[model samples]
Target: MNEYLPLATLLRLLAVLTLTLAPHVGHLPPWVSALIAGLIVWRGLTAYRQWRMPGTMVKIALALLAFVGVLVHFDGRLGGQNAGTTLLCVMTALKLLEFKGRRDVMVLIFLMYFMLLTHFLFSQEMWTVAYLFVCVLAVTAVLIECQHRGALSPRITLRKGGIMVLQALPLMVLLFVLFPRIPGPLWGLPEDSAAARSGLPDQMAPGDISRLIESDEVAFRVEFHGPVPPPSARYWRGPVFDHFDGRAWRDSVPTFASGLSSRLELLGEPVSYAIMLESQRGRWLFALDMPAARSLPDDAFIGREGQLLARKPVTERRRYELTSYMQYRLAPELDEHARKRYLRLPPDFNPRTRTLAATLRTHYTDDEALVTAVLRMFHEQPFVYTLRPPPLGRHSVDEFLFDTRRGFCEHYAGAFSFLMRAAGIPARVVTGYQGGQHNVFGDYYVVRQSDAHAWAEVWIENRGWVRVDPTAAVSPQRIEQSIEAALDAAEGLPGHLAARTRLRFYLEARWEWLNGRWNALVLSYGPELQQRFLERLGLDDLRDTILALTVLGTSILAFMGVLTLRQFAPEPVRDAALREWQRLTRRLARAGLPQRPGEGPRDYAARVAAVHPEWAQAIHHITQLYVRMRYLDDPDPAGQNALVDAVRAFKPRSARRRSWIRS
Candidate 1:
């Protein structure tokens, strides 16, 4: 294919586009973007003959340098987000030099698609999804352009491809909403799953939960199958840390082995609901503390310590059904070791505070009075709850109580648990987000990392561990307000700004409604949903979707075959071969041989020859004309009429049917 413009120039243009791709995107890291941009300039100069293409040896050496540079930039480990992104950037840059033909551009398009998938791996928020879809269309546009040489304009190709994608949208949605969902990652340990943790760690230093509070990213989403739980009833309890290291708390109990059925005894009214938690890389789940039962798909088991735990680390989105008793009795008998861990204090860490706790214990004879005095101190004292707490060095609880008494949930929880332990009351910390932006549009709570908070639970005589939040005594508005208001200022945060204005608030609300569907539907899929899908479609419990799709695919192929045959049917054969019939009948009638209407071609031909011998030749000529008109599809109306005239001119061997006229 000889070309007008140099294919070399077009190829170089594509190469430059590939090289500059990182810079074009905001999502790509800055250093990579800069390097890619520099490569584009260098390649453009080479294209202009400002410099010859680097010598073969030089190119090879430079490629090795780039490879080493990538390995270094990605911390030498070849996995996870940073490494994957670095590899993509390096390939994108190197592809510029190696550009040869259209196929190479096709490679770039494939890489672009992989890049889109990477974006989904990080965040599947609605805006990200919408942006990535546009990117998909763009890459698809490039794919279509590569298929044709010079005939198709890129603009026209893109438009056509977009139209086709739009046409395919209904089918995609039908599959998305109706198709079954499966729990866990599609493959295995998750492509980028080194991000796993042992659930939200049961311990936190001074800054842990507050740092969690800086994020607005989703932790989990819940949808109930039955009666909806009120907002106040929605305490998605997670980790219960009984072990306290001077500053933080930890998992005091042993790892649950199997079903501790002996430890569990069902009681009180149960509230059944489901929780779809995003991958936190942590093992502990946020339940309402006493989940009565769990989804069969989920490997949920209860601990003797009365906390619900997942069977595996959550590396992918998870959804599980849970039934909980908001008022269940747990650990009617608190063991001595459990009591010690719950009431343990770090020696000599906060001595003065310890002394103060001892004094409070001496002052208040009853445990109820002690709890009342602590809550009253928070209420009456100059203790203020604020997002930006002053940095505490050591003796953090002491600093929080005396000096910079203004701090968030962690401070309150840490101090409250510390004081309870000091008063000889067994208490431990509970960490989870409190309050969420209630979506007015969808009526679902969107608890973000910013909503992360801490509180204490005190084991009492008759009742189970009673929930208490010291922070609530300071700022009652914090729990009532969204976490953004609790945090007050959005400074130093990545993307956790509040929607303060009506317009922005409305826009944010609409965006969140869209995101909630994505979270509930796409990101948070599990095995139960997968089964329900197959069951709904009338498939046997034993069969799977892949087998079902196979059957459907085979049927489609068979139907397509019939349609294709109809599409290419011969039109010439369909005109009834009228000219041939007319010619044959006329000659037969001249021979005193009448032809019947709708008679077979072979039969008519035979009868005409059997007529009077004088007109036998004429009959033969008419039959030959019929064959040519019907088989060859000769569009010769005049020739056909001439043949008819010849038949009339010759004379008939027999009479024919009167219906011999041809339209």
Candidate 2:
């Protein structure tokens, strides 16, 4: 294989392979992929004019320098994205050296494989999967070029490469379906692979949600099996923060009191679905209200806070199955401590709202009636909800209510809750997104940053707590029509968020539907589903080690099979050289001289010369022709078939052995 492959062609193909893999590692340090591209470009420019490769010592020094830079920049923790990316990037740079042979191309092919794995570490998105496949094809193309470099032109070599990988599709799919699902985070793996999952944190500082709004990334996605719930009902309860000290909010308790039972249940009309919440580096589960049963795994616990949380920090694409009962009621009976905590407010806070709550209290008969008055004030007053809210001065709850009535959801919810507590009603602010866009493509919903909302939930008689949104008083269309429909400005905003083109509308709707299905089904692969999945396939005790072994075994055997077929298959070379030699012999026999089969080519030419001296030059030419055509066709293949014509008309006399005395 090494003997046949031409070096120059392999280098060109490897350049193309490296270039094709550029986008997979786009999230890494910007210059990493750029440096690789630069290296490839340099090699190509040099190759185009047949210049010398960069000096060997220079390559060695660069590799050492790149490795040290990766170590120092990643702070010596050479693992996960920081490590995999470094390995891939530096390897591509190092590959520029020794890239002048078939084996060199093989090394590049391996590097490309590692690059694909690095892409998975950053994002396992379906589209990224598709692009990685294209990278794999490019790698395969280089391998095929290494094999047939000299025998075929670059265009023909690429065609052969495509045909080969396409033929390999069946085996790849068969292996993917049969691959076992690993039960947990890979054994002993480091924690940094999930550098990309950005979930809402449990602790709430003054500007916690403020920074989150700056991001348009999805925290999670939901799809309904039945008629989709209204955007107003899209309350995804996650972590419950109660310990507030005027400046920041923390958990009431470090550990959940309800334990795993909070995520489980006896029975209900199971709103069957899956949720793939991106890792938030915390142990909270973001689910629709009232999870009927927790279907993740034994380790994932349900807390009394009405939150689904894993036993450990979610360091990967966290997925779980849930059947939340939309109609299920939270325990209406509040414990002594829980009630006291709900009413606890900063002392001497919001003097004006406190006075107003007292005035309203005298006007209303009961706590429930007093609650209606607060919402009424928002509706009747000139209070407005806008993203561009007036900058809150000190004493936020006070400034928002009396001074600047122009506040967003958080402002309204905060001010409204503070007033309710003063009126002798236990209330808390609930902050989450509102009015999700309905994606008809997957028949589900998508919530975005613009949908970030806050509202109030008040404790009332008979009912545990009822939801109230003062912001809704100002923007009714927000709950009714979704964030997209609530947009009043058609001119200003980021191009991505602004409604500008009809095409944006079409694509957003289309991809929203597709992403909804991806989250619900694919992102939902977890433990309970793992067991049920195995049970459906009739396998128990699925082990990570076993799955790893099976995939490894199949890959090795398949690779061997490829090598064997290439070695044993018939070689497509010219086998007709002997016929040309025989033709020359027959012509000589007709000219009255014969030669034995054991005679050598030069000896036969001598015999022919004695028989007919005038035809000796033609006879001599024909005998030698077979040797050159049969053995040598390198560098150039012009006049490859012309040798046959010279032999056909030759005069090598051997009638006795050729035709058993043609008479």
Candidate 3:
């Protein structure tokens, strides 16, 4: 009935709570983090100093203040995922101040569990899962400590908690495998669930993709069914930008043309592959160039411009299979409206570049020849392919083409597209990823943000849209090798993309392979996959599947229940000295001097000595030796043997004989 809590127990709870809240520190507001930290410290101090609990009015005021803070920080919106997580954290911190006894601690521990679940809302990566597992173990240990009748050592409590977790593992696996998964995610994802992801945007400008090149995050990973595509053929298509506004290139209104199949002509043999795409929070699904219509995923379709797109934004890691051809003709016959759309440019920008385009056009009467000339010029000129390019003026393409002459892929693609449009060639800039690093250990290609690229797609008379990469003309290494090889040694690259020692490379490759397996085998286990697995097990019918799940689930629960009950089962006597001591106690009980419950050896021995004064010396000696051997820090083996010998030698008469002697 006591409302008091031990300091050690309180501190253990705080430690676990801190562990649960650590991952949110990166995304939670700084003020919220500080408030939580302050509250935690104050709670610890209150427990240590035995301070009174916060008054009800004070708790109410604190709650209101936290609500206001969340509202103000989130710009008056509290319904979104971020706002909700922040509020949950705030409420948890507030709860810490009033933590008094068993009820409050239970509430706090449950809150910790809920907060731990919130992390998966942001990221469900392999590392995130591992971290959450550790947090769960720690929190479980603290919970066990709370229920214990007496204080338990941290090691003992953790061991017991781990045993419980191990016992439940079978049930967990059964539920995960047999639970009838619905289509898509288990729950509706909040709007902001995919916030803070990085990849190619819906638009591209001079520095947009170049900046993306600095990030080493994987855009997607591909496992080719047959031979892997060559480096030059590894252009994963994303958003196509046809509308140029001088400074930026934006995607035109998408027309999911009914005649798309008629327009696209596949030339070369198709390359089939499966892509495990990371969340980019955009509708554009990157696939190899010119994805075939037949092999497209059920939820995705090829856009009017030949780029693959999802029906909805990819808010989680997704796996999809597709067939694409390196050689293909998209929109073989361009209509007037589409032609005008691709060629339209701002009237007053890049005058010098336009003039140069005109002069090149004049020299080469044929459009293909003009395109060849531009690429040749890029190859012959002093244009440097570098990550750190000089800033451009208002006429960005003009500056890059005439003055600076050094830029990343986006700059080259933008200038090339502008010149093609200027010279009266229908052209547009296509932004996506170019080269990917093959994770040899996993036998998959990892396309990263650093591989993000922009190239010009110009329409020709018979070829339809021809892919022209001006950057490749300047530096072939970028296409043939990697971004690291493309740039000079002095130009900085992301740490993961940079060169590493052989040992480090090996470790990283193994880790990446593990991650790939986790993603493919675990995170990508959706409803369809579950159904396939169940069908393999001959549980095709819904009723059969549910019945199997129930039977297996009940069996696991019953097994775990038996294991748990065994832990509480009384232990059998094992030690020789203890067995002899028990025999002595039995003899005393027969003589009507039974050892009571919770009686210690010394106390029992003293009471028996009082009952039989003649045997006091022998009883005291036995009890002293037993107590020393059983309870002392370092009792000798000799002492244990001595206690056993002395208890065995001690003899007592029955109660009737003792009473006769006393009479």
Candidate 4:
């Protein structure tokens, strides 16, 4: 089997296989990728040394071992993207060992194509898509070489392959535009598609959000149809934690009291916008604080505490239109269940913080006054807003409030919520992004994970859950400006956000704008966009779309076929001359005057003349001219013209006699 494959083809196949597996390294188990690399190295060495391949039994044993390893590593769950991709990768590596002939190469190449598709399951970023396209081109070149029987120059093969891809681009674009797209997932998404992203977690531990502040990954991007909201009003609400354990805050089972309709009264014109959210592998959707009651996406619902909840986990780039009113009230008249839930706090925790809350309650008569007193305390006290805050013990709130008055937004929000609850006011922590950077190039706001924030929402008798940002009191710049502007210059921000040069910053913004457009126009192209595209072509329903597609497809196919035939078809006069020469040789062979291999035209003509003396002069003249025109370096144009005439005029006398006898 190995004898059939040339060394060049084997090397090319190995190169393509190596590159195809490179992108999956980060997603696959470390050992799996490492095993692949080792196998590739061994295969290359074997090919170079002309060593014998492993036996079938040995290959089988190795494959079984790899399969067992995958099962063990993936917890015996041979389902979804992770396990399935791992299995694919393992089997692909094993396939290299069993490489025999062209059939195996074809099978290997098809597997490579499938592996290329799996790459998009994990990432659809601009760079990722570009990388996959380049891989496709290389794989296509290998496929072209496999089909070619004769040796072709590397440059020529690559050029022809590239041309083929370029030729297909227009048709591909047409299909993408006219194809009937299925809404949402036509098939179940692989579990590996969902990854852990740097966003608000379901539960907030002491330093949970502080860890997220360091990451500059964009959580989402928002484009306003009307006007961009002010930074102070841009509170993108996420998870509302009602259940407070001793150490952390988590959402608990909803009670009827918490579910009571707050009947939010809109004060002004709603701000309409569309958000392109990055997948967070969770159901929570980030919306501006105080969103309209019914302004959520079709797949989303407003939770009891006014947080947007998606029906399914967000495993892809999701675009949803939303209208939010920054100024609105909910549950102004706090219900009993709501009071019990929001104000409920674990006993035997944060004794010192509770004492201070009691002290503040005695000093202030009303709930509003108590809230103001807490804000004043945060402002007057030496509460340093820093990313690198001292770690707290079990009593996180007490330690932050008294001992270490240095913390992030979570610290401030947690302490504030604790004080409010201790002072007999219903309060809970609301976690989400606070501010976003406005990209002038894109005309949209980019909210990064660094903008992740938390603040207190204390329930007032007359005024529902009033948003109290204690971090603002401690550091007003954080609310007004960005995380970088708020933090000291000594603690540099993540490299992407903190550009060293003005030109670099401008280029970054431009690239980001291009990526934003790519996501919206390309990645977000779904059934609705496809339908709208067809509507522009006067094709409305599925039936019309199919009909129009059939017509367009047939026309494209016919045009392509015509182009192909034209490329392969010969030139008229040149083809006729060559065809006549071949026919004369066949006639001579039939008359027992056949030319022998390596016999020069002059030698063959002499032999033919000896056998049939009647055509001697004609044969001699034609053979002399044919030799001088084709083989000799004669610049005279008359040689070619005379050779064509001599060949057309010459006729084998023996064949003519046979034809005459038959007549």
Local error of candidate 3 at residue 293 (angstroms):
2.5
| Superior by lDDT: candidate 2 or candidate 3 | 3
The TM-score obtained by model 2 is 0.71
Give residue 308's error in model 1 in angstroms.
2.2
lDDT by residue (tens digit), candidate 1, 1-663: 223224444543455356335323565557667777777777665555545555678768867877777678666765666566667766767776655466666676677667666655555567666776676676666566666665466668679779756756655654554455555655454334433522355576677877775565777666555665554445566666777677677776665544545544557677776666777766666776567654333476765555566787777777777777767666656778767777777788887788888999899978878988999999999986666789986788888898899887888988898888888999988777665566778766666666677888898766657788887787766666655554555333325464357888788788878877776776655566656656787864454566665565556556656755776885653353474466556655554666787877666767756654444676567666666776766758776775666656654432332224421
**Which scores greater on TM-score, model 1 or model 4?**
4
Off by over 4 Å in 3: 1-3, 255-258, 567-663
lDDT of model number 1? 0.66
Clashes of 1: 22
CA lDDT scores, all candidates in order: 0.66, 0.65, 0.84, 0.81
List the candidates' TM-scores in order: 0.77, 0.71, 0.84, 0.83
If both were scored by lDDT, which would come out higher, candidate 1 or candidate 4?
A: 4
Q: Cα RMSD (Å) between model 2 and the true structure?
A: 9.7
Off by over 4 Å in 4: 149-151, 190-192, 195-198, 254-262, 498-500, 572-663
Q: Look at candidate 2 and tell me the lDDT of residue 635.
A: 20
Best-matching candidate per lDDT: 3
Q: What is the lDDT of candidate 4?
A: 0.81
Provide the global lDDT of candidate 2 against the true structure: 0.65
